[model samples]
Target: MSRTAIVAGQGALPGLVAEALDAPLVYALDGFAPAIPAQTFRLERLVPLLDAMADSDVSRVVFAGAVRRPRLEPEMFDPRTATLVPRFLGAMQSGDDGALRELISIFEEWGFEVAGVDAIRPDLVPGPGVLTGEPSAADRADAARAAEILAVTGPLDIGQGCVVAQGLCLALETLPGTEAMLDFAALHQGLRPDARGAKGVLYKAPKPAQDRRIDLPAIGPDTVAQAARAELAGIAWAAGGVLLLDRKATLAAAEDAGLFLWALE
Candidate 1:
């Protein structure tokens, strides 16, 4: 039997990937909120998990969902993990992307192929074009501005997504993630007369250097509702670089809310 291991994290994405990939080995990261239950382990148990995977004949690993970096204690490290402390610490200091890359490298070194979730579910990544409703010229312009902003910040390891209204960037997503940024945008809406018409966009794209396999930007039906509540005109996301969840429902919600959903190339 071919076996794949999902180092699951928070959100529904992990469970979705597991379902699409068939019932493979499911190991949830302990303390990480996952959509489904699975055998759990903390970050400090890396070596033991690797051993279990090897014993199970697992040949591939795909990481899914979001997780905050855990602070590992030296006492929790096994002999094998102890040897890796220096490298792990260095990666942590570098940034999230660097740390993920290091983790992927470690998984590879342990003889498992690292896979992208898109491999299991390709339809989730949509192509470039208008997905729902119609975007006004102003909304499109704001989308362009968002893309420009992402270009400058992507390499800096900042968060994805931004809110732009009336050609002015109202909020940039940070550690709090997209929803918080949307809330921030909604709170500050209509500061200018031109912005009072709910003419803005929630634009999202993967950082240029981001590893698509591990951390693709994603939006779902809830996002549409959030954007609607924010009184925004629409949402624009980089085509083939972001994940769309609850596809049919998300589109339907956007249509009902009179919100445009564009997949920007």
Candidate 2:
């Protein structure tokens, strides 16, 4: 019987996926410890890890949470991984989406189907509509600007999120991730060049060209709380392109903090 392997990363996502699976094989990276007990492995030992998985009858794989790029040491590479050095280097030059796609191809070549967390729990991906509060006209316009910013920047492999307030672009998610971006927005809420007093909207979506099968955008209760602290009116995300972890608590948090969570149509 083939078993599913959950390649765990850093965050609450892996645990959520595992809870819904039937006897899942959890392989977590060395540095990024998942909240669940998992078999630890390093990317440097890719071949050996695959061999172990094959021996364990693992046929399906799903990746969850954030993974830091490992430092590839040529001396640590096995004979097989050594041959792929050129491709790895090439992936590095092409940006995150390209690199992830290349990695997905590698998993496919090993005869394992790489799926997103949605495979285990589709409910986490909500349909279009607002989960709380109501957005005003200005909020909608800000959201449109944020959407345009993502559309323009997605091809550049910049980020999946941006903040726009009163027709002003406040922040764009960078290497630091969404939370950091929100913190940045919060810090400059009233100090930025513009003196507008209107609240903003935080918009998130998968990179237009990104392969959603691997890394999809995710938000939990913490995200809603952060957005509220940022003094934003609400958050808007692409429907079916983002994951809402712990849906119940997240929605409640949004309600408690008086922030809207809209899944754009």
Predicted structure with the largest lDDT when compared to the true one: 2
TM-score of 2: 0.95
State the displacement of the C-alpha of residue 109, model 1, in Å, after optimal TM-score superposition. 0.8
- Cα lDDT of model 1 by residue, 2-54, tens digit: 58989888888888898887678888877886888778987787888898999
Predictions in order: lDDT: 0.86, 0.88
RMSD of 2: 1.6
- Model 1, position 203, has a per-residue lDDT of 93
Q: Where is the poorest 10-residue window by lDDT in model 1?
A: 190-199
Q: Which stretches of candidate 1 lie over 4 Å from their true place?
A: none
TM-score of each: 0.94, 0.95
lDDT of 2 by residue, 1-265 (tens): 9999999998899998998888999998888889999999876678788888889999999999888677777787888777778888899778678888998898888899998888788989999998888988888888988999999999998788999998888889987889999999998888544566568999999999899888898989989988999989899999999999988999899888888899998
Model 1 global lDDT (CA atoms, 0 to 1): 0.86
For candidate 1, the per-residue lDDT at 18 reads 82
Please list the Cα RMSD from the true structure of every candidate, rounded to 1 decimal place: 1.5, 1.6
